[model samples]
Target: DQQVKQNSPSLSVQEGRISILNCDYTNSMFDYFLWYKKYPAEGPTFLISISSIKDKNEDGRFTVFLNKSAKHLSLHIVPSQPGDSAVYFCAASALYISSGSARQLTFGSGTQLTVLP
Candidate 1:
């Protein structure tokens, strides 16, 4: 069973507009959520992250919001630029009782965001 899912496979936004990406998870153990942006030939690069303790976290043009009750999260990018057009992956990390440290991330399939000029 897939714990994390990005229902929307793709999204398109006009340049300079706001772009929103959504993700949902079924695991209640998740305590940290992160967003990564990946280019066609490059590895996924960490963009922003939010802890379960907080509902929102922002870094520059990127903002991440988490809704624990709904098991959902979203990433918002304002004034979307061409460079921002890439695959955005939503990932979650949780502390496993069997392990002292947080386990590897559980990632969604990813949503492709295209910024049109």
Candidate 2:
């Protein structure tokens, strides 16, 4: 069973517009959340991250919001650009006391975002 899920497999937006990507999780143990962007044939690059302690985190054009009660999170990108077109992945990590680390990361299948000019 997939703990993390991205309901939308693809999204399209016009350039200079806002793009909203959503994700949901069934795991309550998840404490750390991350959003990654990937281009074709390349590795996924870290975009932004938010800890469970904070409900929201913002970095430039990217913002991540976590709603613990709803077990949901969303990524917002303002003024989306053509270069921002890529596969976006939502990942979560839960700390393991035995390992004292967040080694296991659960990833969603990913949502392909296309920014049309």
Candidate 3:
């Protein structure tokens, strides 16, 4: 079975601190990984993504590292801001992730990240 797991339900940090979120997957075929951030009453917005071929990807305050051998990944947000307070969902998809050829997203339960002012 393909399951993407986010072990932590929430994380809180002070402004300007680093916030880390984790995810794990059991499917070996998952070649594309993505992280999305969500605010209340809004659809998740894509934050960053790392193709399986890359070990790490970074964009500004966000960075993601993947350990293929361990089937694990993490998202790091540096110098967290109060506006960053929201739920973050880590998702995974492969070229064949969908059963019937329709694109499907397998999402983690999500972590509520809070950056205190």
Instruction: Give stretches of model 1 more than 4 Å off.
Output: none
- Cα-based TM-score, every candidate: 0.97, 0.97, 0.93
Candidate 2, residues 1-117, lDDT tens digits: the string is 789999999999999999999999999989999999999999989999999999999999999999999999999999899999999999999988876884588999999999999
Name the regions of candidate 3 deviating beyond 4 angstroms: 97-102
lDDT of 1 by residue, 52-85 (tens): 9999999999999999999999999997999999
Clashing pairs in 2: none
User: What local lDDT does model 1 show for residue 65?
Assistant: 91
Pairs of residues clashing in candidate 1: none
Residue 81 lDDT (model 1):
98
